[model samples]
Target: MLTTIVVIFLIVYLGMILGGLPFLQLDRTGVALLGAIALIGVGALSLEEAVAAVHLPTVILLFSFMVVSAQMRLGGFYDWVTHKLAALALGPAGLLGVLIVVVAALSAVFSNDIVCLAVAPVLIDACQKRRLAPTPYLLALACSANIGSAATLIGNPQNMLIGQTLGLSFDGYFLDAILPVSVGLLACWGLIAWQTRGRWTDGAALVPPAALHEARTEAIAFDAWQTTKGLAVAGALLVAFLVAPWPREHMALIGAGLLLMSRKLHSRKMLGLVDWELLILFMSLFVVNHALQRTGVTAHAIALLAAAGVHLDQLGSLFGVTFVLSNIVSNVPAVMLLLPLAHHPMAGTLLALVSTLAGNLLIVGSIANIIVVDAAARRHIDIDWRGYARVGVPVTVVTLAIAGIYLALRLHLATG
Candidate 1:
């Protein structure tokens, strides 16, 4: 049983690293789900035990926020904002700065992936219309979204997992992360602006007329009432998470329910936007990891590493490992793997910041990056890995360094 569980764990994680098993037509979520089923079949864990392994608070919170973001998307709030921003009378660099700031701010509050998904196509069309090159702005959108989402615990899935698992304070995490995230956003803007210097216009727009027409058709008309309702719920939930003595998950779930009971938007539309695959990925990883923990393998591995002077509990060690693993298996699964060792005072904050910032390392590093790239591709714009790396690599290195220094300073001051 132990051996079976171990093999399943290894295979599932490998799938995570590669985005799927070779020639299997299975994605990370499918691999994880299958691993959990295998564990149950082999009696490594009972059905009840597998079910108990999933953290309901984290799942509920993630689901609730997905609904909220969907409401805003269906209301066309993101598209509306992009058009308004693009209509400004700013030069290329100034517009890039504004794009980074706005995307980061919106991502800090909403799901970064959703923000990118809704904004990228519209942004591309907007840029083409202005006779400005869309590539730099697109890269800025992806990098800034990753950095900005690091600002708050609710900004990304991994952060939500760490916060719920560690019982972290929403406001406290925000206070700890704001500086690094701000600096990282600025770094993204600088790197993108520098790379595309004086080259803001492509000779001819790459986007086809048909693609532009399709984008317009798919865009939702901005509905004031729906957008306002979503904003109200999000704001109230923020206040509740900070001040009220309530479970953050419960508060967010309540907010989602309120959004569902709307007359203008159908509940089906909002719920349809929820990434059920991601939720399943979380649940499946919980079971597989819990089974591995029961075998004492994780404990033994940690002990072995500690003996070799590779202690994960130390801030420096944790920061390095988080950065590496986040790029390898993507942030959410990487956070799940290392979360058990997060016992240090600043471990949660470090994990949240590094895991997220590291996603900017490559195109395959984060879902937001992939979403932006895909959106661009549909409009005949190609942001290949090399193109993305030209911006992604530097933004990642600089942002991670800044976060490391900030956290180290915070730790020093606390100890001093």
Candidate 2:
């Protein structure tokens, strides 16, 4: 039984790294779900035990935030903000700075992927109107979103997972991450601006008319009331998470329910916008990981590693492993795999920070990166791996270094 569990865990994680099973139609989510089902079918876990293994609080919190993001999208808040930012009379560098800051700030509060999806096309159009190049700005958007999302527990999926799983304080995590995330955002802006020095204009023709028209189809006109309501709910949730003793998931669910009761945006539309596949991925991985843990293999392996002087509970080892696994299997899955080892004092903060910032290493490393790239592609602006890496590589290296230094300082303060 232990061997079977180990085999299933290995295969599922391999699929995560490869993005799917070889020649199979299954994605990471599907692979994880199948692995969980296999364990149940083979009696490694009873149906009841599998269900119990899944963390409902984390799932609820994730779902509620998705609805909040969907509400903002349907209300055209994202589009309105992008347009406003474009209308500023700043120079190329100044505008790039503002874009990075705003994108990062919004992503810290909302879904980073949705922020890119809603803003990218309109941003492309805005750049064309200004005769400025969109590539640098688009890259800034992706990088800032990934970095900024590290600022808060709810900033991205992985942070949310770490926070909920470890029961970290929302305010504590925010305070610990603010410095690294802010420095990372500034570094991202500087690198992109320097790369595009004196070449803000591509002098290229506007995107194909058909592509522009298709992109515009997803835009929602700004609805002030809906936007205001969404903001109110988000603000209230943050306050609750920080101050109130209520369960975070319960409060988030109530906020989602309030948003659902909206008369203008139908609940079906909001629900449709939620990433059901991502929810499934989390649920399935929870069951699979729990079954594996029950078999004692994971604990035994960690003990062996500790004895060999490679302690994952230490900040340095955790940071290195997180950076590599995040780039390989993407941040969310990587977080799930390493979260069990997060028993050190600073482990949760380290995991949340590294897993998120690591996504800036590759275009495929994070959903936010994919969303920005795909959005650009739809507008005929190709951001191939090479083009992305030119910016992504530097941004990732600098940000990770900042995070490492910050974590090291915190560790020293704790030990000293």
Candidate 3:
């Protein structure tokens, strides 16, 4: 049984790392679901036990936030922001700085993937209008969103899972993350600004505005009344999560219910955008990781690491391991694997921050990068790997440095 569980775990994770198994017709979500089913079939976990292994609070949190984001998406909020950013009549370098700061700030508040998806097409159009290269802005969109999402619990799915599972204080985690995120944004702007300095001086031939404008078929069909109502519910629920002393899951469910009370936007459509695959991914990983835990493999490995004086509690070691593993398997699974150790001193903050920031390391490192790249490709704006790495590599270095320094200083201050 133990061997079967371990083998399934390995295969599922391998699928995650490889972006789905070769010719297997299964993506990460399908791979994870199969792993969970395998565990139940082999009796490593009972059906009841598998259900129990899945964390409902994390799922609820993820679900509710997706609704909130969907509301904004439907309202054309992201599209509006990107257009505004593009319309700013700044030089190339100046526009690069503006784009970096704006993308980072929005991403800090919303899911990174959604932020990238919403912004990419408009940004591409905007760059074309300004007679500048869209590649730099698109890359900035991907990298900054990944970095900025590290700032808050709601910013990334992994952070949401970490925050809910560990019961980390929302305010406390934000306090820990804000400095690094702020500095990281500045660093992101600097790197992008330096790279685009010369290109802005000699503007590329402009693409027609009509061509870009025609791409937006889905207009912002916002009911101001409904949008305001959803925002109010979301804000109240956020406060409830932080301070009202209600269970986080219950508050989020209330918020979701309130959002569902709409006259125009059907709940069916809202629910469709919820990325059930991602929720399933989380559910499946929970079972897989829990099944692995039953084999005493996790505990044995931790004990060995502890005996060797390599505690995950240490800031340096924690950051190093998280950066490597997150880049390998993506941030969500990496968070699930390491979250068992989140009870260690300052571990929740470390886990959330490291898992998120590590996403900036490569093209496949974060879903946000993938979303932006894919969106651009759909519009015939090819942002290939080489184009991405121009911004990705430098952005990763600067942001991680800022995060590492901030974590080290906090640890020092806390210990002192």
Candidate 3: residue 101 Cα off by (Å): 2.8
Check candidate 3 and list the clashing pairs. none
Candidate 2 colliding pairs: none
Model 2 segments more than 4 A misplaced = none
By lDDT, is 1 or 2 better?
1
Residue 238 CA displacement from its true place in model 3, Å: 3.2
Give lDDT: candidate 2, residue 42.
91
lDDT, candidates in the order shown? 0.92, 0.92, 0.81
Q: What is the lDDT of candidate 1?
A: 0.92
Q: Tell me the TM-score of each prediction against the true structure.
A: 0.99, 0.98, 0.94
TM-score of 1: 0.99
User: Native-vs-model 2 lDDT?
Assistant: 0.92
From the highest lDDT down, the ranking of the candidates is: 1, 2, 3
RMSD of 2: 1.1
Instruction: Give lDDT: candidate 3, residue 1.
Output: 72
- Residue 405 displacement in candidate 3 (angstroms): 1.2
Candidate 1's residue-wise lDDT over 57-153, tens digit each? 9999999999999999998899999999999999999999999999999998899999999999899889988999989999999999999999998
